[model samples]
Target: MRVVVQRSKKASVTVDGEITGQINSGLVILVGVTHDDKEADAAYLSDKIANLRIFEDAAGKMNLSLLDVGGQILSVSQFTLYGDCRNGRRPSFIDAARPEQAIELYETFNRFLREKGIQVETGRFGAMMDVALTNDGPVTLIIDSKDKKA
Candidate 1:
């Protein structure tokens, strides 16, 4: 499992011209699952994202966690994050999880975030989504569960 998180003023996901999920003053999480990913990956990433202290504090420092700010999460499953482009112009999704596996872990990740008391909105699993956001400070980071396993 891997995730790209961006602090956002507002964000939303649309599918087939219909808005499926939206959030304000929160984070937009683009999630990907590989074949090696498991339930524990979901738990680990969710916990990290919830506690990540990237938001500004009272001193205007980046010291507030998502929980501290009572922010929401717009979670979108994006297997394309695993697209590998080493050899050809066209990207390869060989590292991406099968749809069934990806969807399972994707939803599980959101469920874990919700369990942590943060509101979570999610786009339809396996759908082509249109995600838009006003990135705050463009605060973005990537986490890979495989590295944590070491």
Candidate 2:
């Protein structure tokens, strides 16, 4: 499991010219899954992201977590995060999970976030989506479940 988390003041996703999901102030999460990803991976990332302290506090320090700031989440499924371009000009998505598996984990991930008491919105899985966001602080971070030292 991999996720690109971006702090945003506002964000929305449009599918076929219709807005599917939107958020006022929160993180826009681009989520990806690989062939071997398991429920544990989804669980790990959901907890990590929910508690990540990227939002600034009153002292202007990045000490506030999404939970602390009562922020929303706009989660988008993005298999492209697994794109591999090491071989040629074109990228290969061989590591990305199949749509069936991807969607299952994607929904599980959102469910995990919701269980954490965060307001989570999402783009349509397997749909071509146009996402728009005002990236707050332009603060972005990439997290991968496989990177855990343990």
Candidate 3:
């Protein structure tokens, strides 16, 4: 499992010109799953996302977690995160998990975050989406459960 976690002042997802999910002062999460991703991967990533501290504190140090800041999460399913571009000009999506399996794990990931007491919103599964955000601090991070394990 892989994720692009962007800290945002505001964010939203629109499908077919309709807003699906939006958040204020939170995160825009682009999630990806691979064939090897298991339920544990979701659990791992969600836990890290909830507890990882990037927000600033009183001294302007990045010491606040999302929970401390009362931030929400706008989770979006993004299989393209798995797109492999090293081989050729055209990216190969062979590393992406099948939709059915990916969706289940994706839901589990969201649920896990909620279970950690964070508010979460989500994009429609398997949809072409337009996501917009004001990236706070322009702070973005890539997290891989596979690498985190090591």
Ranking by TM-score: 2, 3, 1
lDDT of 1 by residue, 30-121 (tens): 99999999999999999989999999998999999999999999999989999999987999999999998899899899999999999999
Tell me the deviation in Å of residue 19 in model 3.
Answer: 0.8
Angstrom error of the Cα, residue 87, model 2: value is 1.0
- Highest-scoring model, lDDT: 2
Whole-model lDDT, model 1: 0.94
- lDDT at 50, model 2: 94
Question: How much does each candidate deviate from the true structure in C-alpha RMSD?
Answer: 1.0, 0.6, 0.8
lDDT of 3 by residue, 4-57 (tens): 999999999999999999999989999999999999999999989988899999
What ranges in model 2 sit over 4 Å off?
Answer: none
**Backbone atom clashes (below 3 Å) for every candidate:** 0, 0, 0
How high is each candidate's TM-score? 0.97, 0.99, 0.98
Winner by TM-score? 2
Candidate 3 stretches greater than 4 Å from native: none
lDDT of each: 0.94, 0.97, 0.95
Which regions of candidate 1 are displaced past 4 Å?
none
